[model samples]
Structure formats: C-alpha cells, structure tokens
Target: MELPKGLAGVVVDQTKVSSTKNAVLTYAGYPIKELKDAPFEEVVFLLWHTRLPSADELSEFRKRLVSEMVLPEKTVQLITRITYEPQHPMSILRTTVSLLGTTNDVKRDDPPRILAKLLTAIAAIIRIRDGQPIKHAQKGWGVVENFIYLFSGQRPTPERVAMFNTVMVLHADHEFNASTFTARVVASTQADYYSCLTAAVCALKGPLHGGANERVFKMLETIRDTGQDPVQYVKDQMASGHKIMGFGHRIYKNGDPRAVILREVARKIAHETDNDSYFVLQEQIKDYMFKATHLHPNVDYYTALIYHCFDLDKQTFTMMFAACRTAGWLAHIVEQQAEGCLIRPSSEYVGETNRHYPSR
Candidate 1:
C-alpha cells in the first residue's frame, strides 16, 4: 500500500471540540470569524461544553476559572528554580509543566483547574525569566485581564484586553494540529492531564509548529535593523533554499482565517504602541511574498508583531502560544479520556521483509 506521508488527509478519529473543515475554523459549531471578538472565557466555555454558555453560566464559569488561576506555592518555588536555566523558554516550560503535575494533587485536578494552573504557571515562567515579581490576579477582573496583568505587571486598557482576548481565542484550538494530536495520543493512554500537556508542549517546541512565531519576529527584526529591502531579503532567503517561516499553512491554501482577523489587531496595536514601522515592513514583506510565491501569511505572521507590541520578548512567543492553547489541549484530553480508545495505530514494514537473518 502507498501510504500517506505524515498521515496527511487521514481521519483517525472524531472530535466535537473544534474543526478546520473546508479551511474554515470553528469551535463547536460557531465559526471563528464570529467568535473572534467573543470574550476569551466565553470561547473557552464553548470549546469545553460544545455550546454557548447562558449569561449566568458564563459569569460563574469566568469566576471559577479566575479563582483557580493561583498556582500552588510549591509549583511556584519549583518553577523559579528551573525557569532561569540557560535553555529555551519552551524547554523550561516543558519541565515546569511536568513539575506542575508532580507538585499538585494529581487525582483531584479537573480540566478547569488544570487550565487555570497552566495559564498562571506560564505567566510565572515569563516573570521569573525576566526577573520581575509575579503579579497576583485581582478578584474583579476577567480572565484575560488577570492573565495580561500577571505577566506584564500592568493592567491593560479595555482596547488592549479585547485585542489580546482575540489573540488567545484565535489560538485556543485547531483540530488535530501537531500539538493537539500529541496531546490526544497521550490522553488515549489514560495519562493524567499534565502528562498529556507536557507531551503537547514537546511537540509544539519544534520550529515547524508553535515555534514559528518567534522565528517570524526574528526575521522581521533582522530586516528592520539591517535596513535591507524586504523584498530582496525574501528573495535572497528563498534563493538560498530557506523556508519562509510564517507565510504558509498546510490547511488553508488561499489564506488563514485567523490571520485575517489578526491582521487588524496587529495594525491597531502596532499603531498605539508606536511600532508602526515594524508593521509597515511586515506589510511590504507580505505583499512581496505573495506576489513572488503566491503564499499568504498564516496566524503566526501577524501574531509576531502583536506580541511585540505588547512588549513581549521573541524567545517567549511559543510559551504564550502554550498559554492560549492549554484550553483546547485540556478540552481534547477530556474528550479523548471519555472515549476510552487507545490511539495505537499500526505501521507497514517493507524493508527486505522476505530476507532471513543469518546466524552470526
């Protein structure tokens, strides 16, 4: 049999959490374009429940999630020790996530609490690495507000909160992407939530997956700092057989839907933060890439600028991705666990199968 490479176009199982069928991303049944501006907590509720929450339910859910945002004292102490190691932020994150599982009460932890702890833990990683004091989550603020304040140490304005909320929602889930698939495979083994998430983080640490956003920013900064012609820089990179990091996707050939929404957010935040020059260079490079290669930017493209505008370091970009994606990861873990199906697939053997080994 001629098998598909990397299981491309293969449907191994089903999901109710989210989908990218027909190249349009939807959570439950609601399209992402409509959900782009929805509250981050509301989108989380939808992903876990497969339906929109009632008003009272949403209010309570937000409170519950926010309430669980505090990390255990032992986890924080352990995170501080490992966070400043001379390794990539994603590597530190992988270790920290495993530590969370070890330090916390594994048996009693549920999805909401796990998700909360993951977010808070990610923020702590950022703070510790930066040598900044970790900020506490305030009681009256929503989840997004607390998250931003936790890492940034400043309360974001309403407009900024809305933009970051959209960023988180856009990244919350994509069905069967590499990291989510990794999480599902681990979950199928009846593993704990932290184990599943740690596996997902490892998969996402690859440059081709969640690490693309950081490379995108590095490329942008290189072009900007060197004052090179953006178009020529791209041509030179391509001529040398380099893959452009943020300009294409496997699923969306015409364009990434999330990129469409994020482009506006990137523009707005860039202008407000006086990073318009970076945004201008991005647009120039984007046009050249499309005219030259017929490739459109993916979600990582605009997010590079958006995170930069929020004063985030490029190295920590994938960790931010982990924070947003924990929701979908937890949701899928729950689903895969309930289904009780072990995700063990078979492989074909074609290497000299008829040959017999001689005694040696």
Candidate 2:
C-alpha cells in the first residue's frame, strides 16, 4: 500500500481554514479591511452565514442573539453559589463551562442550532463570572453590549460598547488556533458539539494560549510601580532570556493584526479612565520593543490593558477569552463534524522493540 505523502500542510484541514495570500479575511468570509468599520454583530452574522448581513439582516441577527442570550435561572443560581468561594471567577467559570456539557443535554444532529446553544452557555458563564446582576436576553441588546450589561447591570456607553464589539470581533475566530484545533480533533471523533467545546475550553485554560494576557498586564504593572524606565526594564528582562508573556506567536510573523486593533482600544480605554499616563508608558515600551526588535505585539499585550480598564480580576482574564472564543470553537467544531473526517494521526515508532523476551 502506498503510504500517502504526509499531507505536510497540504490544506488538509478545510478550504475554510486556509488563509488566502495578502487577504485579511474574517472567519465570516468577508474581508477584514471592510468589516473593521462595521459593528461586530455584522461580523458574527458573516461568520455564521459566510456573507455580511445588510442593515435589516444585521438587525434581525442582533435580535436572535439578544433573544438567545438568556441563561436559565438555575444557571444563575449555580454561578452565584460558586461565588461563595474566593477562588478566581475564571476558575469557577471554566469549571462551570465544563459542567454545562453534563447538564445541557447537547444535541448533535443540527450543527447551527448546536452552535447557538453554545453561544448561550458560554455567554452566561462569562457574565456570571463578571458578577453582573442577571438580565434576560430580550432587551434588544447585541452580544458585546449584553456581555457588558450582564457584568455591570447597566447599559454600556456607546463607546465602550463599540470597544467591546471590537474585542469580540477580533476574538471571534482565529483560524486553526490551538483551541480551535482541539475542538476539531474532538469533533472528528463524532462526539457531540458540547463535548468538543468543553474540550476546547479545557485546552484554552492553559497559560500559553488563552490565559497569557492577564500576566502581561501584571508584568507591566510591576515594572511601572517600580519607577524604573520601562524600556530598560523590558530590555533587561528579555536580555536575561526571561520569556515575556505577550511577545511571541506561532502565526502572524509580520505581527498580530488583532494586537494593533487592541492597542487602539486600550488607548481609548485608558483615555476614558484618565489612566493615560500609565497607558502612555505602555505605549513607549511597545514602541521601544518594536523599534529594538521587529517582533510586534500579540493579542494578550493589549487585552491586559483592557482588563485593567474594565476593573476585571486578573485571575479571571482567560475566562473572558474563553467566553469570546466560544464563537470560534463552535465554528471549528461544526466545520469538522460536517466534513466527516477522522482526525487521527500516526507517529513513527522509535522505541526499543526487542524486549519481547521479558514477557517470557
């Protein structure tokens, strides 16, 4: 039997996940350059439908998400009970997300409907961790605003809503990412969507992927409080071969595009909080780092500042990432399941094989 060429990056995944040369396409299939100015709801719709919704279409899409955003009273109570502990909300949230699979009775046949269910479960978990009073999803709010409202029980200002929207859009779907790949692997096993999603969240719980941003912020805070020059601080730290949290990536060799957008959002939030000085120092460090080494910032670099502005608990930061990434997780899971391919791979055996005599 011909052992087939190892499919080494042969677009084996799907036509969907492949990146087109020089095109910044969103998960939704629209060019990012165009959607950058649009509300994230539009982007979400595009991801689901593979085309941007018109004004009316977007309005209807928003209504569906708003209506679908509600979590059950039981879920609210569950999250509240977990708050009894001083453990970080993210830890609780992550645990709760895994628990969702056990309780939700996930349906496997219809992928879109399953994705919708995941959207609700993830949003509720995230909102509960943010500690906002419960609000039913019927109030005609978008996902970003709803998430904000669920956290604060108040309407997020227009600008903040836009920023949140930007965050969601940027986070919605990263192509073939670690967590996304994990979801695909699970789905390829013919498991239910919820289980695949739960697995993805579990994958994202690691610090290298979903949870690095909070640490990045903490690092910045430590350096700023020490009253030393941040450039010197970063340079010395990197010189000593200490891995800075938000500086590297497996993709986007040119730079992480999301970081550029997030930096602007961080600056905006900093201006909103009158924390411009701290933000300015951060900016100076970013400039110095980029100038000194051409390596640009990754997603976590600016999300750290966003977390600071939101007054979010540092430990819960990755939970927020998991929440936003549910969109991508669902997308990949459905794509893999629909494609109907097994994800199993083989490894070359390199172990000692003559030990059969030991069995005798």
Cα-based lDDT for every prediction:
0.93, 0.70
Clashes of each: 0, 0
lDDT (10s digit) by residue, model 1, range 1-360: 888888888988999999999999999989999999899999999999999999999999999999998988999999888877677899999998999889988887988888888889988988998999988899879999999999999999999999999999999999999999999999999988888999999999998889999999999999988999988899999999998989888889999999999999999999999999999999999898889889999999999999999999999999999999999998999999999999999889767767778999
TM-score of each: 0.98, 0.86
Q: Which candidate should be chosen as best, given lDDT against the real structure?
A: 1
lDDT of 2 by residue, 60-142 (tens): 77776666565556655676777645676566666666665565545433433444444555455555655555555446666
Report the Cα lDDT for candidate 2.
0.70
Model 2 scores worst on lDDT over the 10 consecutive residues at 1-10
